[model samples]
Target: MSKVENSSAESGQVKVPESVVMTVKNFRSASDIDNFYRYINDNRLRREAKMILDTVVKAITPPKRRRRSKRVVH
Candidate 1:
């Protein structure tokens, strides 16, 4: 099994790795650092809101059933 599958099986929740890479030309001032902090905070809030919305959607929606294939006999 893959690492993701094993983790999901053990914890009942999947762990996905997320990242953001950016190159800053002049990242030397206090305001620049503050702006970066605010950006991170905003992203965190958005992610949390998305997770809550997804949970609510899942609770409201029904699970889909898989169709079974029938074998043909000659």
Candidate 2:
């Protein structure tokens, strides 16, 4: 079972559709996850998937930062 399995509708929470669950569990890349994210019809399920995707993206992508200029001290 993948991490996606943890977000199943069978858990007795908000019932996410099976198609959505299947899509997520079978995800092989970020684009697959994004497809499911767009496919979910339920608001609650969509939010849950969004949260997971956001976390996944954050974990995989490097953070961007602006470099500061160095100053000489007198």
Candidate 3:
């Protein structure tokens, strides 16, 4: 766990624990032009929480039961 520092103007206060800045930096540096798409695709959930809802919909959906086929007499 790393700590980042940022300062506020109006309040004149200093804050820390802005690790997301580091995460983005790491993400950019590690990813190449072609692989960047994969990186974004992989991190889409982290970028936007709404993706979890979409995944939940798929997870909660009930699977359709298949009807048994009757065997014909030979």
Candidate 4:
């Protein structure tokens, strides 16, 4: 397995793996290519949106504190 560098943030471009590219190229119908691209884009968007929402929620939410019990000394 090759290490994939995430340069999407820096370049604003998605780096499709060579294998996926070749597979897509081998697809017979144009609709197949379109559907594949759409699926990829939708998944990427959903993941990114979820990450952003999680970050925002974490930032806005307060941290939980544990409650301490009081003990009586005789």
Candidate 5:
């Protein structure tokens, strides 16, 4: 039996949906154990925000200069 299967049986609740239970387990593993009980948590938006901030940082930083140069002289 799977983790969700065992949990559902112990809690006296109807068999939990596989996808929902997997999502719950993954979310719990990603966060600290102390707050893992917060079932409403979703990190997708938080990770997206971090990605946006990183992109903005890269945009604002100066680009590296190339050694190539073109000049004409007689």
Candidate 6:
């Protein structure tokens, strides 16, 4: 894995493993998806993270789930 050495702290470039890049390219498991979310959540780069979360993460996560109500009366 080629280590991405952060050239500058102010650059807002975080080092990511090659495996992580591969996983993001094609998710293999829930953990892979989780890694994407975690990266967005954990990063101090709010603007970048927000953009990805709003576009990609927002699309993939389930919107909602509803259950039918059941009632019995005498």
Using lDDT, give the best candidate's number. 1
Task: Indicate the residue-level lDDT of 73 in model 3.
Answer: 100
Taking the tens digit of each residue's C-alpha lDDT, what string does model 1 give over 23-67? Answer: 465453457677866776877776776687799999999989989
RMSD of each: 15.9, 13.6, 16.9, 15.4, 16.3, 17.1
Residue-by-residue lDDT tens digits, candidate 2, 1-74: 56557676457566567756655445755676566655775445867777888999999999899799989899
Best by TM-score: 2
User: How many residue pairs clash in model 6?
Assistant: 0
Candidate order by decreasing lDDT: 1, 4, 2, 6, 5, 3
The residue-by-residue lDDT of candidate 6 on 1-74, one tens digit each, is: 23345453456778677765664446646675678777767886668867866899779989888887888787
- How big is the positional error of residue 39 in model 5, measured in Å on the Cα after superposition? 16
Candidate 5: clashing pairs of residues: none
Question: TM-score order of candidates, best first?
Answer: 2, 1, 4, 6, 5, 3
Q: Which ten contiguous residues of candidate 4 have the minimum total lDDT?
A: 1-10
lDDT of each: 0.72, 0.70, 0.61, 0.72, 0.68, 0.69
lDDT of 4 by residue, 1-74 (tens): 23344556466777877756655446755676678668768777767756877999999999999899999999
**Could you tell which candidate, 1 or 2, scores higher by TM-score?**
2
Output the better candidate (4/5) by TM-score.
Answer: 4
18-37: candidate 3 lDDT, tens digit per residue: 65345654765654633865
At residue 23, candidate 6 shows an lDDT of: 44
Deviation in Å, model 6, residue 69 alpha carbon: 1.1
| lDDT for residue 47 in candidate 5, whole number 0-100 | 61
Report the error of model 4 at residue 43, Å. Answer: 8.3
Name the regions of candidate 6 deviating beyond 4 angstroms: 1-45
Candidate 1 runs further than 4 Å off:
1-44
**Which window of ten consecutive residues has the lowest lDDT sum in model 3?**
1-10
